[model samples]
Target: MKLRELRIEKGITHKQLSDDIGVPVRTISRWEKGESDMLLKNAIKLAEYFEVTLDEFINF
Candidate 1:
C-alpha cells in the first residue's frame, strides 16, 4: 500500500495519524505492513485525511 509513503510524505507518525483519525496505532502499523486489511470506512477516512481520492489512495 501507499499508506506508509503518504504518511511519511505528510511528516506524521503512526501514533499521530491514529490519534487524528481515531484508529489505533497498531492498526495503522498492521495496515502499513500488509498484515491486516483496512475496512472501507477506515480507508475512506484515510483518503480524506490525506486529501486524496479513494482511487488514488488504494492504487499502489
Candidate 2:
C-alpha cells in the first residue's frame, strides 16, 4: 500500500505520523504524495511506528 493508504487504514493523520516519527509534517505529506523519496532513517522510524517493514513502506 501507499503511505497515504496505510496511514488512513491506521486512522492517523500526516501530522500525527510526523510526530510519531519525528519528521516534519510537510515531509510526511511529500512522502505520501510521492513528491519526495523517503530517507533511510525516516523510513525505519515510519516502519517501526506503523508496525511494518521498510520494504513494505517502499515497495508495497
Candidate 3:
C-alpha cells in the first residue's frame, strides 16, 4: 500500500507517524507525496511500527 493509505488505515496522523518513526513531519509528507524516497532504515522503522513486512509495506 502507499504510505498515505497505510497511515490512514492505521489511523495515524503525519505527526504521530513522524514521531514514532523519528523523522520530521515534512519527511513523512514528502514520502506520501512521492517527492522523496524513504531510506532503508526509515522503511524498516515504518514496517515495524505498522506491523508489516518490508515487502508488504512497500507493496512489492
lDDT of 1 by residue, 1-60 (tens): 589999999999999999999988999999999999999999999999999999999995
TM-score of each: 0.96, 0.85, 0.92
- Per the 3 Å backbone cut-off, how many clashing residue pairs does candidate 1 have? 0
* Residue runs of model 1 more than 4 Å from their true location after superposition: none
TM-score of 1: 0.96
Look at candidate 2 and give me any clashing residue pairs. 1-60
After best superposition, candidate 1 residue 53: deviation in angstroms? 0.2
Give candidate 1's error at residue 55 in angstroms. 0.3
Model 2, CA-based lDDT: 0.82
What are the clashing pairs of model 3?
Answer: none
Candidate 3: misplaced stretches above 4 Å? none
What root-mean-square deviation over C-alphas does model 3 reach? 1.2
Residue 50, candidate 1: C-alpha displacement in angstroms: 0.2
Clashes per candidate (backbone, < 3 Å): 0, 1, 0
Best by lDDT: 1
- Worst 10-residue lDDT window for candidate 3 reads 1-10
Return the lDDT, model 2, position 35: 89
For candidate 3, the per-residue lDDT at 8 reads 92
